[model samples]
Target: MEYYSVDASGYSVKPRGVALPRSVGDVADVVRWAAQNRTPVTARGAGTGLAGGALGDGIILDTSRMDRVRYLDGVVSAGPGARLGAVARLLSGYGRILGPNPSVGPYCSVGGMVATNASGSLSLGYGSIIDNLESVTLVDGRGDVVELPSNRHYSDIISGICRRAGPFPDTTKNSCGYRLDAVPSPDMSHRVVAASEGTLGVVVGARLRTHPAPRRRALAVMRYADARSAAADCPRILECGPVSLEVVGPGIMEGYGGSCVLFAEFHDSVPERGGPDHADRVCGDVRRAAGVRPVMIREGIDRWLAGRNAALSRSLGMTGDRAPSIIEDATVPLERLPDLFDVIRELGERTGSTPVYYGHAGSGNIHVRTPADSRVTEWYLCEVMALGGTITGEHGDGMGRTGFVRRQYGEQNHMLFGLLKDAFDPHHILNPGKILPA
Candidate 1:
């Protein structure tokens, strides 16, 4: 087993054992062992999760090697251990693409993405993992290998869960507690496992839905003189109904203070049938409908897809840096996105610190990376909660945000989360201290 003092960014935490499970049987063995000994286990994937969801004091189950993809009629079965990029590469051969892709694509694991219900710049077009999930197989706290969505007993449990769903946060993208909302629908059973944070059970494998590759593509690079201008145009651009419309504030652009930029991507299923002139007409129509002059439009089917992915991979160069330098994920309602600027700016002023902020403006989900100062970790957490947001949005609350869960979810919600944890893991040995109080 391998251990580290800090994760990707450098957050302070003492990771104990790094267990690499070879298969579902190995996962079950580990769970059984942990249950008997009352040992806690933390599941890890690619170590790319920014929330420290993979951080813990017990054994860390590294699921990176369990990657295996089996394609059925229209669905793909992926091992929880598979890296997201590997899966995407395989799916692309069949003209299929994964739904939600974080900028940190190649490095993240499918399980990690599912754990966080991850969304990306293209999330406006392709929803998160929950939207694409088909089913999941996991080992529950009772040492039972439960196949959700296929078990009638689980359906009854799910129905009961729906009746008791009140104490959870009501939002579009959430990774803070049990995904009870997903379990109510038959198709959403897989979603229940999508963002479980490894606390409810150890995910062995899952089935995912795939989509055909886009045919025609267009981009609208809208430049904003200020953040307000960008915010003002977001709703209008949303009305244009592009496959994906992303916003990156000046904080993300090099040396552009107070300025912001929005990247809009549109997908047309048929491009070979239309000439370049028709493409221009399509882009022009979209621009006119959006009521904003595009600074530039890069046409070409593959070119647009490549550009969107390029923007998503901008976070790959931070290896060997201090841990806390990593980004913290938090999201609010789209209407409250502009207000988040004020909250972050004020928090920085109060804490005497600054953070770089950027994200999927369409969904109001953004990632913030604080300066490399360990002294302000506690303060940054306090401000995040005071602003009526959570410590995690797409990224699950790993060790980094574990200490702040109660405050973010409030007392009532926090207790309900605890109850869900107890129901799933009575002995509290499965990834303890991840999504609930330990």
Candidate 2:
């Protein structure tokens, strides 16, 4: 057991003991041990989670050594401790890939991504972890290995709970609730675990569905006069068929010095018999129709495949010393994105703050980051919710955004979340104070 009073971001939070569990059996044993000792347990992955989901005062079960990969059919069962990048590289050989793509890249574990319901720029096409999850093996508080979505008894229980659940936001990507929406799908049980934040149960392993790698790919660097131009161009660009379409605002340009940038990428498994001229023509049409211009157009098949780290570093500029303290992943309707950008700029004025903005323009999900400080920190949470948006859109409402959950989720949904947390962790011992307010 180990203890820490400081967070990775340097914020202080005291934990009693940190347990490194070497296997799934170890995870179960730890949970039972904690239950018997009347000690709370919080499961931790690589601690790469921006939210304080991994930070708490209790027994921290570090599952880093539980990493392993076992492929069966089109499904890959990876340990909760496995790094996403390592999994991505492993699947590349088989011409398959997972759906969720956090900007933090492959450093985070699959369990962490699932916990947050994470998605990246490619989420425009790939969707989220909820879409990719085939099944999960989680150790419940009673040390029972329950495979969710299966066992009709559990589904019946979940159905009843959801019927009584609160009204959730009508958005594409959300990680706040019990994911009641996921229950109706063929993979309904998978919903119970997605974005649970290790509160409901500790995920020992997960089975993920994969897709064949896209064949031909093209990367386009489009320049906009302002966020409005980028916003206006989103709908038109979608018509051109893009696997990844991301927008970077003035803050990113401040570092890169390109007028409001959009990184557009298209991937198709078909061979490029006629080159990317067709895609380029579509891009040109989108630019012209939207009154924007593209700076560079790059095309490749499987030839120009750089590793995940190279890709993520390029998107999130390397600051060397510290990662940005504030980052946002707010999503809105595609039609509302242009207005959303205007609102964001308006927020900058109100808060006297400027954020580095970028994200999935195709999916209407954008990321914003402000400098970390005490001044104006308190109001930031309210301001984000007032805009009729989520404090988190893709990365999730972990401890970083949990404080703002009630505001974003509203009273009904927020209360439902509390009840769900109570059902999973009646003793309030597992990852206490995460997802739900204390």
Candidate 3:
């Protein structure tokens, strides 16, 4: 029970009980019991989510024990319990790789990735997990086991609600509520469930498309005097065709205080590298990205990569429980990224919270964690929505941002979300109080 509560984001909810099912049949049995008893069911994976998607007060469905992997030609069939890193290791033997590799690293579960539509630094080159998803097998709220796309009956049921759905966001990634866009398209049943966060059903298995891993790789580091400078140059950097382009405060890298740095990597080979006229830059490997400073190549480079992944953890640690707002991971259009940076800085001044910023710049997905009040989240969401961005880029809306779903998509679209929730889980017995406004 201790392990069943709280996610990495520091949000905790004591569940009534936990159910660790060994097979899909067991999962269905538990969900059926919950449905009949009017109890909530929360599906969980590796618990690596930055949002509190896995925390709830009812029956916690733990799938970590269902870890299993199988090969399936162009795609791979994985139990919702399968560890993503383990799956990646297996695929590497076949010269393949999972498309959406979250910076949360290899320890996250496959189900969790699909659950949150996980995207990482490399997502700039590849899309989120939703983009690579092929199909899914799940147990509906009533405990009926079902497979998607292959299960046209369930698809038709979901499609009916989607045909009357409202507008969808124009952003690159969205994990706030039920994915209605996936409906209306018969083949997109998996996409709809992939990011639903278990509101619709309990995931049993998933089929994911794999791609050839890059044989050669190089990382480039460019230093800008400030975030604005780095943000201003992001557009030109994207033109270079690097696999990823990210921005981090100097604090993440070693001994660099008050400096803004951009880390870009190329998968095939090092592209022609250049930045601002006075930009002190390196574009060979990790160390070269640091202007070939006196840091050790292998060790320094490894630390640099680790630092980027640790951005969320670092900000969380800095809060010391005093920060009012833990808001992170928002996506705007590429052209508006510079303006986004300016707004965050202003937001920081207004809130009296230091915003630790970092993320995939090419796609305009950045994480900003500050210690402000709920108003900060509201202001940020309103601002991003005004710019045609999303409240979350990779992290799903759990306890943190679910209340803003209505304003994020407006009343009509928000109502459609409720309709889809009923379409899949009429009793609202699965993952209740998540992705839905009270």
lDDT against the true structure, per candidate, is 0.68, 0.69, 0.78
Runs in model 3 lying further than 4 Å from the true structure: 182-184, 269-303
Ranked candidates, highest lDDT first: 3, 2, 1
- For 1-438, candidate 3 gives per-residue lDDT tens digits of 887877787688899999999999999899899989999999999898887999999999989999999877869889999998889889989988877888878789988888888988877677788888888988888899888888888777677767877777777777877777756577677688867888888889999988777655556666777887777777776765666788887565566677887877656422343333212233323333233232222224446778778777776776557745575788888888888888898888888766788888888888887777777778877888787888888898877878878887888778778877887787899888878953
lDDT, model 1, position 63? 88
Candidate 1 lDDT over residue span 75-149, tens digit each: 888888888778888887888777787877678877777777777766677677887788888888877888868
After superposition, candidate 2 runs with Cα above 4 Å error: 1-10, 185-187, 251-258, 270-289, 299-325, 372-387
Between prediction 1 and prediction 2, which has the larger lDDT?
2
User: Candidate 1: TM-score?
Assistant: 0.86
Q: For candidate 2, give the lDDT.
A: 0.69
Output the lDDT of residue 414, model 1.
64
Report the CA-based lDDT of candidate 1 relative to the real structure: 0.68
Mind sharing the TM-score for model 3?
0.90
**Candidate 2: worst-modelled 10 consecutive residues by lDDT:** 301-310
Using Cα atoms with residue i matched to residue i, what is each candidate's TM-score against the true structure? 0.86, 0.87, 0.90
